[model samples]
Target: MIVLRNLTLRRGARRVLDEASAVINPGEKIGLVGRNGAGKSSLFALLAGTLHEDAGECLVPSVWRLAQVAQEMPETAQSATDFVIAGDAFLMAAQAEAHAAEASGNGERMAHAYTALTDAGAHDAHARAQALILGLGFRMDELNRPVNSFSGGWRMRLQLARALMCPSDLLLLDEPTNHLDLDALVWLESWLKRYEGTLLVISHDREFLDAVTRVTLHIERGKLTRYGGNYSDFEALRAQQMLLQQAAYEKQQAQIARLTKFIDRFKAKASKARQAQSRVKALERMERLAPVLAEAEFSFAFNTPTGLPNPMLVLRDVDCGYLPPVGASADTPPSLIVRQVSCTIAAGQRIGILGANGQGKSTLVKTLVGALPLLSGGRVEGKELSIGYFAQQELDVLRPRDSPIEHLTRLAHTVLPEGESRREQALRNYLGTFSFTGDMAYQPVGTMSGGEKARLVLALIAWQRPNLLLLDEPTNHLDLATREALSVALNEFEGAMILVSHDRALLRAVCDEFWLVAHGRVTPFDGDLDDYQQFLLDDARRQREAEKRARMQNGQAEQTSAVRKREYAAARQTAAQLRSLKRAQEKLDSQLHTLQMHKQAIEARFAEESLPVDEITVLGNELKALNEALDAQEERWLTLAEEIERIEAASS
Candidate 1:
């Protein structure tokens, strides 16, 4: 169990937690929630032993192994498989021991080391790492790619996979779903539910929290409070508490008001002076109850579109994907990702895009937004059709050096009427509606956090008075309050909308129908988010079974052909021998590739002069050992290739 006894923690002069206390029992999957800058991450830092509490006690079981995703962006050429496998500290240690024992040629030590390696799950480490990588949305073909080849979001997914790969008694995940698509989010939620260890995750996705967590730890006004159930339960119980608090505060205020009135009326009269003085003392002695100050409500409505265009946009026989590379031959065909995407965006329609990652959800959105041209299709737009597109990478379109007002001004020039008020004060007032007041309205876009930027994008979109909205993962960076606010705004948006989001809460609140972009086709899904989740689970199960069968056929091909032994003995023998040789060759190739990645990482570390002398020396020794091992592995690989070639030639 973990206990916080009147814990007081600080960041600089700000006391984030003052006499905050809570108790967390073993094996509890907890959701740590608070407003932005409310010290949720700070509390995690404290628990991870990276920060110390200013006062009181935060006691955690010392025997527990803690696992957390590193916040820093990784820069490495290591293969994804090796990178994730390296997360298992115990496995790494065991493997290192085995290597050292083998190098020393100590038979007894080698036996012990090998046993330790098996105990650390070295035999299936590759499979486990690949499973995590695939579960996080990486394609099987991309499993062996260098880590640095991926974009920032995909790299973060790799980091998450690495964290999940580590065995732990306690796991801490911060915004684990931010980069994930709905498919990956579903997979992770399922994985966490099955995790036997303690979990403490900080996320704004209420549905995810409700799905995985049984306990809620809330931080408010420098205090920590624990709730017995999930986020929904916490909201219900908190609302009740807030109501009770408000009622008590009102009653106390009334009594205080009556006492003050009596004292004021008779304080100057000699006859009542004694009574007045007693009342004064009584008032002074009273411990006033503070009123429950609810969080400020944030809600906004999209400006009524200039014109509501029925059937805002239409696509027929659309093949959505990327155009051929620059300077390509005129005969070259476009790379089609989704084919036959025929759809219509009618007024007041709310549609959610559903599919696994890389299943063309974003591609379809891009095509609808006119960011990608249809390979072979007819696209017709209504005369008054105005699109408010919120791209997944909306920040990239924003000018970093420009303030919110500047962004709005540029947008007004492009989309607003010719003579509309583009005045600084007017823009500031509009920005304030989205909570960007005063100096915040003039803050540089580069300096603003992700949620603020997302708000700015929405502000831009709302200003357009678009008849249709195409939002792709708009809530990725929003806090819970902002998400709820966005959801409310979207619900009130009197226009056609096609939304792509991993946030089930936002999806449920905004979308009336769902379009499943699967198998290169667009089709209407006949169910809600719950049914979609089950469908995803079923699809995943089927894929896993298929993969298992493939592995089995590959691994036991020779053993499974006993019935054909007599009639096709020679052919079967040759085929089995070739298959065995090829498998060995492939295994050797994977090992060599992994080793090369490690060697490159070491070399890159060596290039960094800031490393300590002792660390440099250690790296040098490791590099030398790696080189020797690589040489031996290369020789074996060469031998296997030669044998495979000889067998193939003989069979031919």
Candidate 2:
């Protein structure tokens, strides 16, 4: 159980939480939600023990083990498997001890160490770690690759995998779905459902929250409010609360007005003086109710295109991907992600691109938007066609030091009419429509939050009034309100669009059809999001079965008749030896267990009360000797296990 009592927390001069309290019981999955900069992350920091509360007490169980994804990028040469395995601290420590014992040539110690390793499930640790990696969209061949080899987003996924690898009592995940594709996101939703721990996750993805969380914790105006059920439920409940609050405030205001009028009309009359005085006192003593403030609503629409082009774009056997860099060898071939794609996107078409990560959804979008060159085939643009492309990374289109007005002014210069002069004031007014008002219009892009940058990108795209829009993961950094606004805008868009996003709500609300990019081909998907989810599950099952068969074949290939015959006689002798070694190993394990119990008892006694200096010194010496003997026995145990493994391998 976790409890926060009258918690007051601050970041610099900003008060994030004030007299806020909440209780999270064991095994409850909670969704922590708020607008951007509303202190969702700060609350997570407080729970993780990285940030202290300014006032009040936070109580978490002393025995609870917490796990969270690391924000810093990992720079290491370690294999991916080894890095993930390190998340299991207990297993890693046991493995290190077993290795040290084997080096010391203490047969008894090695035997005991092997027993401990087995108990920790060290034998299948690599397989388990690899499974996590695979589920996160890594290929089998990449398992042994160094951690430093992956890109920033892939490294973030590895970090998530590492966090999941740990056996934790409390898990804190902030936007875990940001770096995931739909397939991986679906898999993760299932994985999290099976987790046997308290989960506190902060995410703007509503569908993800709905699937994983049973409770919602909302932070509003420096107060924490707990609502039963998921995000949708919370929204509904909050709406009802706001309506009731508004009604109470209106009723109170009416009574106050009537009292004020009565006092003004009768205060001068001697007969009514006492009554007026009483009314004045009543007005003063009455509890005042503040009107409920509505949440900020965001709404914007794309500008109407200058011309609507029929058959906005056409791809005839298009090979979509990247070409070789300049100065490369003449023989270097182009890299193609999607090959022989033939499709026509007509005017006002809303097509959602669906695929697993690295399966060419972005590649196809880039090719269509002219960010990548087609290695072969043809791309036909319709008459008077204009394109607006939104990259998944906002930095691709936004300049860090440039203000929103500056960005808009530059864009206006290029697309403005021949006689129209660029006006800074006009551009500022246009930016205001997207929520960039007053000083915000002139703020440096470098100082803006991710959500701000995303809005800027959308504003820039809207400025073009293009007949077609190619959006790749456009809602990645947007909050729920902003996403709702985008969905509404897209629904009203008069242009054709190809959207690649993991945001199911936006896709469902805006897209009219779906095109799947898989296995280097583009094809129409005959079903909806739920069907796609089932498709991913079936694909994963098939892949697992295939891998199982491959492993079995590889094992068979390693064993031959001649080798088996030669090793059969040697195996019988080795088996007899292994039995004797196992008996000795079990005896050593018992001794080590007894020593551990004695050491623990001594430590507990010392912790409870003070001991005499002389007695403490004597007990310390005894504890040290016990540890040395235990190490030797563990080493002996490990040595025998290695010998048995070698014999078994040879016989196979």
Candidate 1 TM-score versus the reference: 0.82
Best lDDT among the predictions, by candidate number: 1
RMSD of each: 16.5, 14.2
Per-model TM-score versus the true fold: 0.82, 0.82
Q: Compute the lDDT for candidate 2.
A: 0.88
* Candidate 2, backbone clash total: 21
Name the lDDT of candidate 1: 0.88
Which segments of candidate 2 are over 4 A away from where they belong?
96-120, 417-421, 552-652
Model-by-model lDDT, in order?
A: 0.88, 0.88
> Per-residue lDDT for 1-652 in model 1, tens only?
8899999999999999999999887777999998887899999999999999999999989999899999889899999999999999999999999999999999999999999999999998998899889888888789999999998989999999888889999999999999998879887986896576899999999999998897799999889988767899789979999999999999989999999999999999999999999999998999989999887766667998889877889999989999989999999988889998788888999999999777898899999989998899899999889999999888888999999998898877776566647777787888889888889888999998888899899988887788899999998888899999999988988889999999999899989999998888899999999999889878876887687678878875644466657636886787898788778866875687578668867987988878999998999999999999988997897787677667754653
Over 180-297, each residue of candidate 2 has an lDDT whose tens digit, in order, gives 9998898798688667689999988899998888789999889999876779878997999899999999999999999999999999999999999999999999999989977677
